[model samples]
Target chain A: MNVTTGQSTDAARAIAAGRRSRRWGAWYVTEHRLRMMRTYTGTVVIAGIGSPLLYLYALGVGLATIVDANMGPDAVDGVSYLVFVAPALLATAAITVASEEFTYPIMLGYKWNPTFTGAAASPIRPVQIVDGVVYSVIIRMLVNLVLFYALMVLFGAAPSPVGFLGIVASLLGGLAFGTVIMGYTSTLQEDTGQLAMVQRFIVLPMSLFSGTFFPLAVFPIYLQWIGWISPLWHATELARVFSYGYAEPIWLTLVHVAYLVALIVIGWAWSRRIAVRRLNS
Target chain B: MPAPVIVARDLVKKYQDFAAVDGISFEVASGESFGLLGPNGAGKSTTMRMVGAVSTRTSGELGILGLDPDVHGPEIRSQLGVVPQSDNLDTELRVRENLLVYGRYFGLPRKLVAQRADELLAFAQLEGKEKARVDALSGGMKRRLTIARALINDPRILLLDEPTTGLDPQARHILWDRLFRLKEQGTTLLLTTHYMDEAEQLCDRLVVVDKGTIMAEGSPAELIRAHSTREVLEVRFGSDHNAEVGARLARAQGADGHRVEVLPDRVLIYSDNGEAELVKITEAGLRPVTSLVRRSSLEDVFLRLTGRSLVE
Candidate 1:
């Protein structure tokens, strides 16, 4: 066996220097998860840069031509079809990023790798673990939103300076969707391909029906309810209002912001509860 | 007397109608190494979790570092180091980062944690492998790193649940050596293991647990002496006829001052003078296939207490 002299006394001094404040513990948990993110930085960067260009090229440039030829240019919302669809695409990006960031990593924290249990053994509270994970994902969403927003700018998608407000709406929309998905994922004990089903059934349908490519007014009254419940739709409408000054009443704008805020609060509370329950159980 | 770092009075952890850890009481004094000896399903891990302040006790008093686990869990946990049954090192992080990140969980300064990480890597004999990914490391390396990570907080008391369960003999001995060093440094240690030799080697005192209850509590030597005779005589008369030999031995146990236990493959005769007992058995016109006499161990004590082997 190999023998190495231990600096037990120095190590003890260092440990004794640790802060007992609860907030630092939460920050440290966030720090650790952020480092975990660095392992897949390549994938993150590619997704951040690639997703927006593909959507803009495929939908804005390619599909916009047919819509323009049929409806005449500026037929929808008094702007070109490309400009009108851009804000919704940004909202969709945020929601897509939210769904991607929240599922597998949360499962890894709870089950596959059980890194959360390792943190649970430390001084950090269980709810802080939830906060830390959500915090990291929000940061990831912000980055993705910024990169996509920049692409939207370079592609001539933004027609007004207030289009930047679309980024805020996208983030709120992501949190509303991401944190709720996070709460649901934390309660899962087994994978069983459910997240794939979520992508297939929930995320896909929400993106398609949330008026990302077309206005909800074009849909029949019954089918428009999908846009009402969907966070993406609320965010898209809010973004359009900001991006190209898409007309809407003041109270209706407040409803969009309130809906996103409510979803965030509910999702935040649920994720905290589920995380604590699972860790202590 | 030094204060007990951990005290549990009638500790009970009930899951609905089933008590995972039934009413059991014990204390671990500062700097004293204690063991919870039990087989699988014995509630040792459950008790350890309660003491570690990770799992809530159903109805019991568990005071860690003289603080109530229910109210001061995070505070108490800040001062304690816990090594769970399985090594849950972050496979995504490098070997050194595992210690640094875990140290930060205690709110340690990153600079200090980084400095201590190097020293701990050396202490755990993982010096050159600091940059290796955790998943890329061998089992022994991973266990050593886990131990090092637990020590990042320099906890006054360390709780280890089956620390060396999956390790090979060499690895187990290496880990035992590290734990012995920790004990020598006056770190209070609490561990759970079903291996009798592990209990004997590391524990200054131990409590035998089975089916969620404490069966006996004492030092390993004292438990062996109290619950079993000084020596155990093993006599195997072929699997087919061992039961017949065991029955004959049981009939003579009263006169011989011994006890006979018939197991699946062999019969164990508990007696002070095992050689003399073996001679008496052979003199009764029974030629055994093989026989040996050895000093009784904690395995014998557990068998005498529960009528079952410690590791089945």
Candidate 2:
């Protein structure tokens, strides 16, 4: 074994680890997860850049022509169907990223690979680990949202001068959905394809029935309840208001903002509690 | 003990109705290599967790580095480095990155950690393999990397749980050498292993634990002197006749200290002069298929105290 010549005494370094922890612990953990994400950086970049382009090309040119030719180019909200649909696609992108980021990796951290236990042993708190995971995902989500918003402009889908504000609305929407899912994922001890089940049963249905491509009023009142409860619906409505100046009651717009923020708060707190219980046990 | 770094008294941990770690107490002083010797499910890991400040205790007291784990957990943990029983290296990261990232968790500076990671890689004898994928390394290399990762923060106390349990002899020796160097460098070591040879080789003092309680506590030689004879004569007879032979040996004239234990395949006779005692036993017409005399070991001490083998 080759050790360095200048070995500082152990006591000094040990005290340094403790002192630094109270200030920068969460950021360090965030730094670690981001490095883990870098292992598959190619996959994330390709999927982030490629998927949004495909969604826009398909819906903007192909589907917009059919809908506009029949509905006089203002079928919903006095905008082309593609323009109406772009924000929903971006919001769904966030959810897609959320589900992929939250489930199996969280399980891996806790059990399979148990990297979280390794983190738990350090001076950093388990709640910091939870914060770190969330921060890492938020970083990815923010990156994806910016790229998707750029593409939304390239496709001439976002027409309002302030269409860029949709990025913030979409990000908040994503967190509202992702954080809640993260809280649930952190509590899971067994996988058993449960995340896949959530993808198929909950996410797929929410995307289909949340009025992503059409006005929620088009659905019967009973089916509209799906739109009411779905975070996707809340996020999409907020993004629509920003993307194309889509008008609704002021109170209704406030409701959309309130709903997503509430879920983010609840889910973020739940995940922290779960991390404390599991890591400290 | 001089300037005891870790002090625990009547430490208890329970899960619902069952106590995983019942009232166990021990103290480890600065720079000492201490051990908890026990079989699987003996709660060695639980006690290590409590002392490591990763788990909360249900009752009793634990002071690590003069700080309480309940309130100063992060502070206590900062002074300790933990190598868990199993490797949890991030397969997503390269070999060197595992050390760097772990150092980051302790909130060390990136520049400091970078230099320390290289030094640790050298200390672990994997200097050129820094960029290798974690899964690409051999089990021995991975274990070494895990150990290196633990040292990234330059902790005062290093907590290892069965550090060499699954390694081959050569690999185990390599680890033992690395650990010996740490001990020489003034890093207090607290490890747990069921291998008596491991306890004897590494531990300056140890507690014999069974079912979450300490059965005995002392240095290896002291425990041996207290619980085992100076020599142990192992004699194997036909499987069907060993118990009967053991009974005869227990009462045989001029044989042993009169302490004999009958195992499934062999009989153990305890005496100060094993060779002479063996001669007396054979002369008494109690012959065996095979026999050997060896110095008493911690294994024998454990058997004497618990009426069971350490590994079984």
Candidate 3:
């Protein structure tokens, strides 16, 4: 019995809704999101499988032969261009999928459709909603990254035995970028082309300048900052370290991990804070 | 009286300099059908949100089921069902899936939620809509489905914010019938509405609100009895002459007599016997364009308190 606030003893201890305090509330919201994503299962599957297959075939087989013939047998760091570009392509997939999951779909949950409010009306807190969304999108990214890695294996681009670790690297990379956008979207009361503007000005420029198809050193010094700051570049660099054993200082490798992790922590905290404020306001 | 299931004291909600809900207080006993009656922008929805434990009060003390909402928000919300003013149903899921998903949000057992979803679908008259998409349902069906979804967790209190705002007459009647049954079953129901008829039909007691403050509070009968006469006699002397005729009628009734209300189209004479008042008006040599006598209702009570029509 909390006498000061008038909360009853029986009511305080006897948590009622589905039984007690919501230990699994976040997972339940994740299940709902997964079911909603089921409506677009076809698109997810085709994009997951088709994008990797198409990109790998064109770059690894068709273009890699030209580069290998012109610049000698081992073109990049004594390895074929196919091996070097495959890891970047995998990280790029992570960023692309993360951006798509974080933008309009978030808009739909908070404004255009507002199913998140319906969830918030129950015992589920707003922070749980944020965690649930992150979990579901992480699941989607896992499946896609795994498929991309499998194609890299089939194309013989993954030379080292530990190249499968790139999937974990790419997953972190997705969260690093995705959660920041998720936090930003939670504050939108109404959309007046802001999200589309974000997609155009931020997402498109990120993939291009992150050295996806070429080495950052060839892009000159001033423009290299784009690669240095972009999550895609750090993730791609980290993935390249695993696949075909691309050479870099061990400390620089640790910096890539720390950078993506810092982004994830900051972005995730920002999202939870903003979601709770907006929903409880 | 039974213990109150909900209570609010000096509840205020502000958005910067603009106050959406000014200082107001109310209490609802167990199994009671309470309502907040007001026009749009009168703080009814804001009050509902605070009571539902979803929105934070700017300054207030609120207790739902004996727990402070600010402290035990998840606990209080778990026991309450909220039907928002707008339908926020998931368009991506099937109709029954909406119920199941919402029940799961409360962490309810899956098997129990499934069974209740079927029963609630039947109760909402959406028996065959288990697999139907939400977008396919009609307006009335969607409202019913929303109600059904709210009940999936078997909440002790149901909070409906303007439950029948956009429905047609037939749809409103059906929804009212369902609400009446929920009341009969001893569910503590709290609702907000602008329609006097809706208040008359559903609320056991209600507060008349205007401009973010409560103007009056009572049952429909008691409010009408206190603020209005037994009957009202409306005399239309044409819109052009309504003002001068209203002044002449005021003189006929005298300053101490019953009230004469001049609307844009007609003059309403509030008295015990409207027919007798009409007779007196005619004998006084005022030839009205038309006349009618009707019983006073909450509509008249609201007009008396706020000096504005309920629906306008």
Candidate 4:
């Protein structure tokens, strides 16, 4: 207990002489979170590459083969069946990745690990922590999109040069979905299987019913409203327009962009407010 | 005189109908080691959180570094370091990374943060363990890292809530030593603790809080001197007979000025001279299985003020 090398006092005084900068602290949190992400980089990369490849094979190659054979080569929208479904898959991948990034990790930030509290105690504010987490998740989404797109190109699923625009559409869809999940996470006091409920109820249902695997027109009109409300469908429609020049009215395309943008903006606002309130309390 | 680093005037924190902290007022001066001493749920932690600028007061005039917390929280927080009751270290980061990241949170330059991280690791006696994961470290190591991380920004004031709560005696001593060094370097420290010995060792001035109110406040020596006797004579005459002996001792003529407190396991006879008082008790034909005379501590003062043992 009395073990002293006398460096502590000198170090303490040195620290006392240290200076503070007014630079944005959220980037520091983002850097810290990014470092944490590195620990799971191997798994993240594998899953990023593997999931899209499998989905493209199963949905685009396998399912599309059967659908195209039944309906001819220009089956759904005068493009290959693989291309018709590729954009939707990209949007679904983004949403699912966003769901994973936002839910359990946000819960961990609040409950499991409480690393956010440590950040809150510093000069960094709660809003910055919220921003930092969202920013890092977006970074992850970008990487995931890159992997998904590379696979789409490999399988000849993405044909048009304009397909690169799907990247923006896919990322917007992710942010819109992720921010709301984050906002919900901030209100959680305990796990109690709420996240599992979200995955089972909200995420899975949205993925299945959001016209990811098939066009919304194929669904009965009664259930087609799900596609209208779901951010996945909005992004998928936008991505399809970009990916294969799938024709759509300009106003409808504007509506898709507007809906996803609205969700992102509102979700960002709510999550920031809730996170700051919870951290302050 | 310069304003104290922290001042709370009738601070209140309410959660629905229950008040975690009710109308408590206190001041902590610059470079002074102050404490909020109380058992768990007594609002010591709540008070620390408010002073740390993380928790808002329900209704009160509060100031940190002469700045209003409500109006200048970020600015005030920039000048303070806080070690919460629980270790909230980023378990995902290595020990050194923890310090570096915390420094970054203060918006320090990356190179400076790296240099400070090295120095801090050494100061925490964790130099060799810099690359070790926080989860892999011992409880003591984690605590030291937390303290080291807090100092990364050279905060004007350091707030610690139960800093050594779960540590072993050896670890506690090491932490105390590090805190002592920080104090010697003129860092203003505000800590909360249920440990009476810890308050005595660290705080130059402290307030005894109970049930969301300040029971008493003074330096350890002053508090003990003012509230408790110079010494205490503790005697156990079997748990069953303690109350009986206490009643007799209370009624005895010569022990009039002394205070006798009966406990479940023993009887405490408070007097200026405990040895002499014990002699008097022995002469009264009261034989005890065991007895000890020791100087009073902040624990005695807390018991005197609150009518309950510090631990209880």
Candidate 5:
């Protein structure tokens, strides 16, 4: 009986030591993000950065001369066509970064590689797994937005002192889109061509209708509803308001900020719940 | 008295209308090599998943390392290592990067992770494949790497779900060797396998699970002895002649005069002395085209309990 008691005490001590040494889930997710960056750094630099800069130069500077010759001096905004489209380009870059970084990467984490499963087998809980993934996406979006903003300034796309706010607006736009799309990605079990459909049907239509390429007033009254509900439209409107100081009521400005903020909050909560269900169920 | 390294009481896991793991209870001691032996869809994997704390139980209680998974999932998991049946290696990373990244998930220091990665790669016999991409390695190499990655945290309990299901003979032998070494080092191993040979080789004591419940549990020899005769006599009198031969062999009994089983291709006569049965059959003028006598094994025990082969 004494020997058995001694054995039981030793077992209790070993288990106690085991519980004390568990790893945090955040460390696991950060490692996955770093590995992802290493694998795709070359592609990100060439496609994410290079393509946007080339478009800015080719359309903003190269084609602006042709448009200026056809119209009077103030054909765009009492400034060159290049200057008018520059801030819009900054907003566009932010939306693009959000779309690219959020959807497929979230799918990869949940479905394809299932690194989260590996992490869950450790001391990290499912909620921490969700937090780590969101944290990584936010970091990536900010860095990419900053680099894109710098390029916009260097290329003479940003025309006003308030144009710097376009960077902040772009990040807000990305956060709104990323948080929402991550929620969608978390519920999906299999790939089933949904991601491609999102890129083509959803992202393409939103980019076209959100006034990134043209003024929102040109659209028919009913069609304008597409821009009104869009986070991109809100971001673009905020960027235009800051860069050109568009005359608007204080209530209207508040509405724009409210739209983006609501998206970030609701999307984040929904995604976190979905992640917990899918991973821990 | 050691409080059992793993303990469960009436653990149940249900998926919608179906119960994947019905109410079952068991305990495993520290440093013991235990096995869940069963066929596919026998609920062994589901049981392992519950023990690993990845799948939540529908009812009853389960505790790993003296902690409840519901409240302390992360705390319990940190001390446990799991090798899933399927190889889900990160194909994007190199062999060495896989181990290093897994160590980092446990929040190991960078220098410590590097040192452990080197040691594990060598231990898994993947020393020279460090820089090689996962896709570039063979099935066996990838499995070894996964095992090494699971051990990066120096876990006390290792759970393996069919560790060598789809490997070549050489790879299977290599894996068996490594597992044997780990067992000798006093690591508690819990494994699931449909292969009786694998269970016989590795498990000190095992539970034969069938359709979500344990059919029997004991050491290999004890199980065989308890559920099967000491020896079996197999006689195949051609394919179509089995029925006639079975009738004749049934009349010619063993020393204890037990009945015989008639199979499609052969007849099995269960007895303590198979050679004596064979002599009685020959003296009765029942000439079989082929005949053999062998000791009963765990396969027979499984067949007696479940009425099906272990693999099928």
Candidate 6:
């Protein structure tokens, strides 16, 4: 009985230590997040919000006239071309923020400065370091998404109460992309143009082919696979299903959510291992 | 009596195929200022990393505060303060915020962190610059802030890895004084420095390491006396002269049967009495352009054993 109690006490001590380490790690992440926000908030607001707005004006207003005239009055769901593209724009903005927040910042934490080394030298453990970085990125993504969503409302792109659920979908999409890409970033050693390649070859292709600006039915059968696999496509489809009442099978929606959640779980486990190797080794 | 604050036996650390710290072992008694004195790439930093519980050793027994680093790294690290070779201060935060945030990493209460920051700032001589950003501070100021941040936990042992490497002479002196005060207050210090004078001035005992192994270990005076003569006579014989003076000086012997080393520019005559050696050099008909006698030091001891210049 005494031995069992001692073992339980040891387990309790370990639990307490783990909690303390996580608390320290959270503070470290908060400081990094706040510093990033203070320094880059203006840049993000301009690029994330302003760039999307400019793209919307230039593409929606300038090019819409010609496209609308060709496709006839009923071509765009009985709405303006601008309205048809607005929700897609919001989803795309969230994905862009996720890509930026996940890649270079994750690399910097692991390689450039190794802030984790200093933190781990304290009471914080390697796993907490990983958690802290992920938490900070999530917070940044949420803030950016909220701001973008607010701008969408201002532009009258939100069609119903269910339209607000698009922001949550966008967030889930961001987490899907961020987690998977962060795993890749943690394994990289050199500052190669690989991230740029991902942006150009992967993200751009997915964005252009995933029916963000048009319906997937308009695409060739071969190209339709892009929408089926793209997280942005899944998110935009879910958003449109909620916004315009486009019908999707319930199992299909579950598949979309499962795809994202599965990626997050797998990426999280891989990231934890990478953090331990990079730090303790 | 308290147990040894640090203990290592056959500790080895390898990076791929290269052994950075190859089976080195040593101990530091509590409250003693221990130094690892060596040239650049002599594995001093690697040894300190193992002791600080930041770098894992490949094989061997290691203990900090009587606990194994493999099992008790976080616990050991919490009780130890480390100042790395580089000033990795957060450039975005104010000087005081760096200390406060670092203290928070140790899970110290915010009020206690604030109080400790003030005390450490005063100790590091940066009390007035608390509000200034880290990037706005000078190199010396950044180094001082790093030191102050390290002390926030009031650790049982402090490890400094080449703390004065890039600082100017005046800045180095100030840092040395602060470290001396910490030593006086009975803080156990383990430092690595390539500067022999720094090791001599601050370390009560030190190990001279090279190629990841200890060459000698003792107090500075004791190591010098053990490996070198009491005094050394330096003779420079212009650029043109070489082996002729060397042959003559090699033939001449002092009362204690000491020898001389001849180089292209100078010849060092080792003996018990440097003045007597100077008389012998004159009598041997080798007129030198310059001559000086000085007491033997760790530099001389290192040169004798390594056959290489300390600074090079």
Please tell me which predicted candidate would have the highest DockQ against the true structure.
3
Report the poorest 10 consecutive residues by lDDT, candidate 2 chain A: A1-10
Flag regions of model 6 displaced more than 4 Å: A1-19, A22-24, A45-52, A55-84, A111-114, B239-244, B251-256, B259-265
- Cα deviation of B23 in candidate 2 (Å)? 1.0
> What are the per-model numbers of colliding residue pairs?
0, 0, 0, 0, 0, 0
Model 4 clash tally, residue pairs: 0
Models ranked on TM-score:
3, 2, 1, 4, 5, 6
What TM-score, to 2 decimals, does candidate 5 have? 0.91
lDDT of candidate 5 at residue A120, scale 0 to 100: 68
Better TM-score candidate (1, 6)? 1
What are the per-residue Cα lDDT tens digits for candidate 3 across A4-34? Answer: 2544643564255534436787888898999
Clashing pairs in 2: none
Evaluate all candidate structures by whole-model CA lDDT and list the values in order.
0.88, 0.88, 0.88, 0.86, 0.79, 0.79
Model 5, A176-262: lDDT tens digits are 877898788788888899988888987888888987666788899998999998888888878767766655688888898888999
- The TM-score values for the models, in the order shown, are 0.96, 0.96, 0.97, 0.95, 0.91, 0.89
Ranking 5 against 6 by DockQ, winner: 5
lDDT of 6 by residue, B1-312 (tens): 655778888889999999999988888988999999888888999999888877899998887766677776777777778898987776656788788778877777789989999999988889789889788888888888888988998887899999999999999999999999999999999999988889988999999998899999999988988899899988888867756777666776534478667766778888889998888678867688899999987888777778776787
Interface C-alpha RMSD after superposing true interface residues, each candidate, one decimal? 8.7, 7.4, 2.5, 9.4, 4.6, 5.7
lDDT of 2 at A143: 86
The residue-level lDDT of candidate 2 at B253 comes to 33
Model 2, range B151-203, lDDT digits (tens) per residue?
A: 98788899999999889999999999999999999899999999999999999
Candidate 4 backbone collisions, by pair: none
Native contacts kept, each candidate: 0.48, 0.62, 0.62, 0.50, 0.42, 0.29
Model 3: CAPRI class: medium
Compare candidates 1 and 6 on lDDT and give the better one: 1
lDDT of 3 by residue, B1-312 (tens): 866878788889999999999998888988999999988999999898888878999997787878877777888888888999999999889999999888888877789999999999999999888899999999999999999999987888999999999999999999999999999999999999988889999999999988889899999999999999999999999989999999888877856488988898999999999999988888978899999999998889988998888887
Q: Can you rank all candidates by lDDT, best first?
A: 3, 2, 1, 4, 5, 6
Candidate 3: misplaced stretches above 4 Å? Answer: A1-14, A18-21, B254-256
B10, model 1: CA deviation in Å? 0.9
Model 6's CAPRI class is: acceptable
